[model samples]
Target: MKITKLTNNISLKRQLEGGNEEQLKTVRNVLQDVRENGDEALRKYSEMWDGIKLDDFRVSQEEIEEAVANFDEQLKQDLEEAAANIRYYHEAQKRDGYKLPLANGSWLAQRIIPLDAVGLYVPGGSAAYPSSVLMNVIPAQVAGVERIVITSPAGKDGKLPAAVLVAASILGVNEIYKVGGAQAIAALAYGTETIAPVDKITGPGNIYVALAKREVFGEVAIDMIAGPSEIAVLADDSAYADEVAADLLSQAEHDALACAVLITTSEKLANEVAEEVEKQLRELPREAIARKSIENFGHIYIAESMEQAIEAVNSLAPEHLEVVTENAESDAEKIRHAGAIFVGRYSSEPVGDYFAGTNHVLPTNSTARFASGLNVDDFIKRSNVVYYSEQTWQESAPKIARLARMEGLEGHARAVESRGWTKGDK
Candidate 1:
């Protein structure tokens, strides 16, 4: 990692930009093929990509039980504990439909309805995340979604990762499928003979998965077009260089395009963190990937003051922001745009990623500027409830008709007038 002086914000902005048009084109073709051919296309693509041919894509109850039996006792306990924490946290987020009484004797409310079915896409192959299973499923369960299905690629052996299955089973998610990539997303969005269509799809994958989610957005609701994982550490002299380096490396190791940034007021701390990042990179198992990420997108900026540092952080709108300063909590308040904010050095990014009960599926790149992380809200829809008393309608009809007429919606005006309330009646 190199320490650079903070200058043009645009330069930093350009580093976070991602998504390849070439990959999107491929993803589009895959989605189209699956849309047209459904199950046959899914099987062909599965064989082409995963080197496996499947007569049936759905994971059986026997398979789920085998996965549970095969998993180590300690790992199962950890998953259960993590699931408990996640479920408990999200249960608090569970909300009910609300009604409000208006002064005009009208009633307005919102019905918070959970989706009937939800599809969770978990990455397989080199990137199998059981933690993602827990993070994605728990919220949907809490939101009262009746059917929660998971789609992941199978290996050459045609078996899902035992850990992934174990986590899903722990959450009582029985509908598991052996499909992945853009094809799997298309299956969830459009449905096939084998896999039923879902109301929404949520989780993370590579560029293909992200582009697929973007393509299938309207046909089936999707959580977000997640980009590469990223983390921004806002540190001062009070922050530990080694810990900062470790946190940065954690995200960097995720992908060659993953971003790890540090914006600090102290130039000394910046240089120390850069050196510490390099030292830590030497020992990481995924050093090649982390080094490339650090070389390509990672940066350490020296800000003139704490205000300037916070300005840089908000401008970047990173997915994960860590405030490691003298008053970490106070400094965290200044952050306006970030997917998740971690305060203090001990509250590292991984704590939130796995066991802290916070959803790890966060808005990535700069989308945190407007979007939010996956939660129960993502799995539910809100329908506005409106009721008006005859008196209220009578009193408001002329005004409503006049507004409707202004918009050239005479039919709307007439509809409002049809209830025996006319223009100038009030």
Candidate 2:
């Protein structure tokens, strides 16, 4: 980890890995094949990519029960409790429709409706992403989405990970599919014979899955095109260097491109954290991967004051921000641009990632400036509803026509005028 002075122009925005031409071409080819050939394409690609071959993609009840039987009881209890916590947290995000009355019995309204179906793309094999399953599925369930589906790559032996199956079973999400990559995205967007199309898709995936989501975005709604994970710790001298270093390494181990940074007022803390990060990197099981990330993107910035530290953190807009200061809550309140904030020493980043009930799906690559983590809102649509009375239309037709014609949309102007008020009649 490198230590440097914080500057006004300091930024940690990653250049996201948008796929190259070859990868984009492959993504497009896969999306098109799945769109046209349906289940045949899914089967062909599942075998080629995941080495999975099944007559049907859906996971059966028997399979789910077997997975549940095989999984340890303690893990099942933990997942169920985690699901309950997640459900409780997201319940607050549910929205209700509203209508406002206007003059002449006219009214404008908004309808909050859940999507008919949504697909969650859990990366790796099934067992690898049970946490993702919980994170993505619970919110949609909270929003009352009717059909929830899980898509993951099967293991070489053509089986989904048992933990994943158990997690889905805990949530009662039975529509699991043994497919992955761009093809899974395509199958979600355009229905295959075995898989039904969904209105929205969410979850993290590799470059190919990200590309496929990008390509199919217009055909169906999608969560943000996420980049690698990242974390930024805004700590003061009161924070322990070792604890800060450990938190930074948690995100660094996620991907080689992942970023970890510390902006602090104390230069002493900066130097200590820099050394501590190197010491901790050696102990990480994913040492090589974390080493690459820490070497390339990790840093500790020395800020002249807390104000400067907060400013630098805002500029970065990290996916995760941990505040460890004398006034942790006060400092966190001042932060305006973080996907999630961990306050004080106890609220570590992983708490929200798994058990703390906050959604782990977050915007990365500085998109925290505008985007948000997945929530009930992502699975629901707010449709604008309007009911115009005859009297209201008669009173507003001429003005509406004039505004439409100002934009040179003659057809639009005429359409507005055709509601019984001619140019001379009004």
Candidate 3:
């Protein structure tokens, strides 16, 4: 990390990588083929991309049981406990339809309806993310979604990650598939012989998966187009340089494009943290990736005052923010933009990523300026309900018709006016 004086003209926004023309064409073809050919297209693509022949796309109950049976006892207990925490937290977010009172027995209500089905796409390759499984499945389950599906590309050995399988089993997720890439997205959006279509899709994947999600968005709802992981620390001299460096590196190791930043009022703390980051980076497991990320996106900005530092943080609107000042909670109140805020030294960013009740699927890049983390609200829909008593309608109909006519919507005006002033049969 390099130290930079916080300048008035600098911008922290990073653009999302859009798919190339060839990738877009490939995604379109794959989606269309899957929509038309169903399971056959899925098999062909799986064999080509994942380097494995697909016999059965769905994971069997026997395999689920075996994964659960062979999982580590301590890890099993941890996952169950994590699942309980996630379920308990999300359960409180549940909502019911409620009506707004209106005079003359006329009212409107907002209906909260859960999607019938949802698909969670957990990335698989060299690494495994059982945390993704737990994070995605628990909220949809709490939202009361009836059918939840899991899809990930199989390894060359023709199996998804065992840890992922174990986590899904812990959550009692019934449907698991050995497919990935755009084809898995298509299968989830449009249905195959074995897999059924879902109303929404959640979770992240590679560029191809992201493009596929963007392509199928109107057909089936998608959470958001996630970007690289990011963490911004607002610290002062009270913070430990080593602790701050470790927290910055936590997100930096996620991807070569990940971003880690520090904004502080103390020049001494900024320089100390910069040196500490380099020292810690030398010993990290993913040093290559973290170094590249820190080299490109990491920075330490010295602000003239804490107010200026807080201003820089809100301008950045980072995905994960750590407040390690004299009064962490008090400073956090002044912040307006962040996917998740970690208060105090003990409240590390990883706490929310895995064990904490909060969801880890956060908006990355600078999208935290407007986007939010995944939650129960993502798995449900809201409908507007309207009712009008005869008297209310009669009193309001002419005004409604006159307003519709002002907009030149003759059909709307006529529709309301056709309801007649009185209910009487001669």
Candidate 4:
């Protein structure tokens, strides 16, 4: 990993913008074709890209039962444990809006309503991520979403991964579909003959799936179009070099484009981490991808002071931030941006990813500054409610009338006027 001072703006814009005009146009065309041609277009794209033909896109109960039976008892127990932890954490996030009565007898309240349906997209190609299934599905279930669906690509044998199916079964997501890519997104966005459209979509995917979510934003609500996973560790001389190296490699294994950064005040620590990364890289199964990611996008910045380290971390706003300094808790509190923060040596990134009862589907590519990680709140909506008694209307009549007329909205003034309240009433 190379260390460079932060001094580039144009390059930052290029990375943040993600897709160009051409890619947007292509994605838009695919979404349109799916909307118009329906299942016919889905079959065509599945053959062209996935190199498979399917008789039915939705996974059946028999398939799910078989997949669940195939899993060993230990694997099944692990999935259940992860799901239980996720559920407990997210259930605490459930909010019930309250109603209040004013002195003038007016009522104001907010009602929390769960969405009707939600869809989750699980990537299938190189490897399957049952862990991702637990992360995305459990939150929606805790939010009390009515209908939940899972979509992933099928293999040449026309079967979804056993682990993916098992996870879906464990989460009570019966509506599993074999379709993937832009087609699965289209099916979720706009209802097909077989698959019912959902109110919102969540989960991660490759470039095409990301582009599809971007294209169908208004037609159906979507979680952010996620970039490659990222992790930024803010450490100092007090931190162990090998521990820092291991956490960075955890994210690099995601893909060739994934980013892992180390920002610290110790030049010595930086050098040690770089050497430790190389030593650990040899033992990883995804060594080639991790090597390329670390080579191209990874870095170790040497800040002159702890304040400068915090400033550097803010500039990056990485998806995951690990603070391991002399005062790690204090440093973590000073951080303004990051999807998730891990403090101290024991709080590794995987702890939150698998256990520790926190959502792992977080914002990436510097989106932490504006967006947030997926939670139970994402599946619920808040509606503001208001009611004014005749006495309350009378008290505020003059001000309401004046403001409504000032805005040239006579209907707004008359709506209150119809209540038979005079401007002079007191």
Ranked candidates, highest TM-score first = 3, 2, 1, 4
Q: Where is model 1 poorest over a 10-residue stretch in terms of lDDT?
A: 9-18
With a 3 Å backbone cut-off (N, CA, C), the pairs that clash in candidate 4 are none
| Local distance difference test scores for all models | 0.90, 0.91, 0.91, 0.88
Look at candidate 2 and tell me the lDDT of residue 182. Answer: 94
- Sort the predicted structures by lDDT, highest score first: 3, 2, 1, 4
Tens digit per residue, CA lDDT, model 2, 1-426: 888888887666766567899999999999999989999999999888887677878888999999999899998899999999999999998879999999999999999999999999999753387899999999999999989989988888777899899999999889999898999999999998889899999999999999999999989999989998999999998999999999999999998999999999998889899888889888889999899998888888899899999988888999999999999999999999999999999999999999999999999988899999999999988899999998999889889989998999999888877767444553
Q: State the displacement of the C-alpha of residue 304, model 3, in Å, after optimal TM-score superposition.
A: 1.0
Task: Itemize residue pairs with steric clashes in candidate 3.
Answer: none
Error of 4 at 106 (Å): 2.4
Per-model clash counts, in order, read: 0, 1, 0, 0
**In TM-score terms, which candidate is top?**
3
Runs with alpha carbons beyond 4 Å of true place in candidate 4? 4-17, 421-426
TM-score of every candidate relative to the true structure: 0.95, 0.95, 0.97, 0.94
TM-score of 1: 0.95
- List the candidate 1 regions with Cα displacement exceeding 4 Å: 8-10, 16-21, 103-105, 421-426
Give each prediction's root-mean-square deviation over alpha carbons. Answer: 2.7, 2.4, 1.4, 2.9
